[model samples]
Target: MMVKPLATNRSSSGMSTGKLAVWWLIASEIVIFGGVLASYLMFRLGHPEWGAAASHTNTWAGALNTMVLLTSSLSAVLAHQAAEQGDGKKAARFLYFTVLGALMFLVIKSFEWTHEIGLGFTLQSGGFWSFYYLAAGIHAAHVIAGAIIMIWVAAYAKRNEELQRVEYIGIYWHFVDIVWIFLFPLLYIAK
Candidate 1:
């Protein structure tokens, strides 16, 4: 009997493998972040006094980071557009801008955290501080991860190789931005 070949690489859902994989990854991330945020909300409602701690957060810093992430998202979109136009160098330059935004975000976050910690708002301070750190720390990790991936994608973008990956990275970067959108108000402005 002749051995049958594996099915076509395309999923039965009609989505390309890369796109489907990114969606799946995003879905999983949503569930994780959603659960965490929901838990934080429940705790927040129970402990209204936490607002005092939340108020200690630097609104300016959080707002600045929000703008940075939103701007970086625009860069990611432009990079994807450039890739579609077959302009690898342009795409790489835009990706570099996105990465720079990510760096700026982390730098600002580091300063904020340092200031907070120096003021005695640390992980062991209280529930509000703990949640604040937990949420922001996780988000920062995502930012770093996205920046690293963008660097890799930009390298290939410069070479005009794996152009499709540029779009995939864009999707992930946008999702990261959306997560921060949810987080900023919850952690910084809710008070």
Candidate 2:
């Protein structure tokens, strides 16, 4: 017989245990990402010369990635809704779509980095380049992590098991997309 974990515990806050956990994690992540972006903004504001470096960044590529991530977030929402409706197969399909969007964002980002690096905009190039790579790289790492977890979650969702986890992963995926939304303008459009 399959054993069910304590997956049904609703907190006093009217949230599931799993959802509360995801929110707690997201709160912690906000601190981390907030620190990085705040620091970048401070530096960018103080150093006007950084605009030149920022201008070198490919805005079109950043915008494209932004669109991709937003679309992925929509798929994640659909996955959560499917899970809620007891449609595990549909949830898994939407989760796969979300993962595809994550991969596409990464691919576009990689090409953008390749082009920048080809033009000698290395991380060691200057302060602006350093912050650019650092912030974007951290966000990219999160994308990779979200994609991997999503694949695992999708597997169980396909089997109609742990349907609640679909919602949990969707929360995490949305957080990742939100981070990109902040990063895109700070690192790309601020020029």
Candidate 3:
């Protein structure tokens, strides 16, 4: 009887385990965000007062953050491309730039929050304010988490000659950007 070699390294299919895992994580994230978005829509329709309160949110700030996230996404893609080409150093550089963009987004958000809260528009101000802060805050947390992940990927790239993790990290980062795209128009652009 001949013994077969145990299946190892990537699945029998050849699909990277890292990429597959990221997709699963993204699918779960979609459900969580979908639920949040659905609840927001229902709340928006149920209460007319929210519209008036929503008017108080700074659209320009939100727009700036949108730009920041978009730029970071571009950097993340470039980073992943570099990694796939086995240029870990270049990938690390791009990842660091992406992190900078994320930090810029957070700083802008902090300023927006401070300005709004100082204007006596606290989360307790009204239904819209509550939802606005809640949604935006949750998204901001995701941004921070993505940035931290990027930092870890960057560190790995610096010390290693080749890293398959960069591409998966890029995928997750892009998903974060896509979520913000939907959120930007809904929370900031849409009156």
- The local distance difference test score of each candidate is 0.92, 0.94, 0.85
lDDT of 2: 0.94
Name the weakest run of 10 consecutive residues (lDDT summed) in model 3.
3-12
lDDT, residue 131, model 3: 76
Which segments of model 2 are wrong by more than 4 Å?
Answer: 1-10
Sequence-dependent TM-score of model 1:
0.94
Q: Per-residue alpha-carbon lDDT of model 2 for 17-136, expressed as tens digits?
A: 888989999999999999999999999999999999999999999999999999999999999999999999999999999999999999999999999999999999999999999999
All candidates: TM-score: 0.94, 0.95, 0.92
lDDT of 1 by residue, 22-92 (tens): 89999999998898899999999999999999999999999999999999999999999999999999999
Ranking by TM-score: 2, 1, 3
Model 2 residue 85 lDDT score? 97
Over 4 Å off in model 1, which ranges? 1-12
Over 14-76, each residue of candidate 3 has an lDDT whose tens digit, in order, gives 676667788999999999888888888898888876777778778888888888888999999
Pairs clashing in candidate 3? none
What pairs collide in candidate 2? none
